[model samples]
Target chain A: MALDQSFVGRTYPPTDSYEVGREKIREFAEAIGDTNPAYTDAEAAKALGYSDVIAPPTFVFAITFKAAGQVIEDPQLGLDYSRVVHGDQKFAYTRPVRSGDRLSVTSTIEAIKSMAGNDIIDIRGEVHDEAGEHVVTAFTKLVARADREA
Target chain B: MTAKIAYDEVEVGTELPAQTFPVSRATLVRYAGASGDFNPIHWNEKFAKEVGLPDVIAHGMFTMAEAIRVVTDWTGDPGAVAEYGVRFTKPVVVPNDETGALIEVSAKVAAKLDDDDRTVRVDLTAMSAGQKVLGMSRAVVRLA
Candidate 1:
């Protein structure tokens, strides 16, 4: 099925509040093979003026994708999950992500198009602190294969 | 974060130290679990081959994360980063071997900004097999 062009410019509800815990941050760092003190040591991050340990950059993916699910799983969008390829991702941060900071994401379907029988969809996720401060904006691109190839 | 280098100490062409990120199958598996991006292409060689890929590939986010580590490590703080962006130019092919694959990352200071916060733009590059995998890479890092 062709992608539903009508889904362009759609916005998803803000995600449920995700409390950024120090341990989750540590697990992410360890999984990525990063042993940075700031990610694991609260004192290290405190020295940097943070109240608690901070998450590594790109740690927001888990949260942001959870938010983006509202858009991708939209039944009306006609996105073929089986044929999609992660094309790219870019992050613009107003501040670094830190543990203990509750965060939420609001996703928007920034763009959609068809090229060479492929459906290209771009999603922009705006992450904000619990206090309603903008923290980061993440852009994701996905390319869906042609139905004929399926 | 005691940054000895200030915006005035930088320019449009100062160079940051180069970095290299090794992509091992184990690391990829760990990342898949951490990031919740359990795509088969990042782990299953058979599915990768079906898509005409060389082998199980590295997650694009993993590559981006390694590159960001350089800037954050240099700044001595993660919050110092104001903005970071990258365009995935190519796939990081991971061969199933004991040693796995490697991607070298290098960057230079591209610009400086200091109206409200002291910051510098760190331009980065990731290459594998002598070919650019991620390009137009850059980050703006804040300073004390």
Candidate 2:
């Protein structure tokens, strides 16, 4: 089934603030085998002018992708999660994410297209700090492949 | 955070030292736990095959993380990255073996995006099993 073109430009409400944790940042850095001192040592981060340990560039994906679940799970959209594959990802940051900061994301459907029997959905997640300062914007493209048996 | 590299010192086509990262099943498992992405296709071989994948695959986000290290490592500050993006063109198939897979990443200064901001765009190419896994991968970093 084709997605509702009207769903394009639909904006979801802002998500509750998710506090960034130093340990979580360390864990993520370790998982990727990144040993950059700023990711683990608060002093090193401070030396670099950050108030706290700063997360790696891709760390916000965890937060923003989760917020995008609202659009992916919308029944009216009829997206089959099992068939979906991440196609592309982009992020523009106003500043690096620092530990102890509380962030929230508001997701909006940027575009919806159908091509070669596949459904493509583009979601833009705007992240903000507790003070409503724009922190980053994440653009995600999800492709739902055509069902073989259908 | 300020970048270690000076904008005046870098030119278009300047190359960053290439690096390779190994990805085993354990690596994927650890990434899944840390990133909160418990997709079965990243771990369960059978489920991945059932889903039309060759075998267990690495997460696209994980690959993206690995690729950007080239830029961050060069800048000497993780916070210097202003923008980053990638297209998952191919999956990095990880075989269940002692040597699971290797992602080789190399980047170069592609263009000078801004002068006042001292930012340059770096284009990265990531390969695994001799096939490009990411396309249109790039990062815009602010330099001192």
Q: Each prediction's TM-score against the native? A: 0.93, 0.99
DockQ of each: 0.65, 0.92
Per-residue lDDT of candidate 1, residues B1-144 (tens digit): 544356666677877677787888888999998888899999999999998888998998888889887777777777777777787889898888887888888887877766467887788989987888887788878766
The residue-level lDDT of candidate 2 at B105 comes to 100
Model 2 chain A: lowest-lDDT 10 consecutive positions: A141-150
lDDT of 1: 0.83
Encode model 2's per-residue lDDT on A1-150: one tens digit a residue.
888999999999999999999999999999999999999999999988999999999999999999999999999989999889999999999999999989999999999999988999999999999999999999999999988789
On the 0 to 100 scale, the lDDT of residue B129 in model 1 is 75
TM-score of each candidate's B chain against the true B chain: 0.92, 0.98
Pairs in steric clash, model 1:
none
Off by over 4 Å in 1: A148-150, B1-4, B114-116
How far residue B95's Cα lies from its native spot in candidate 2, in Å, is: 0.7
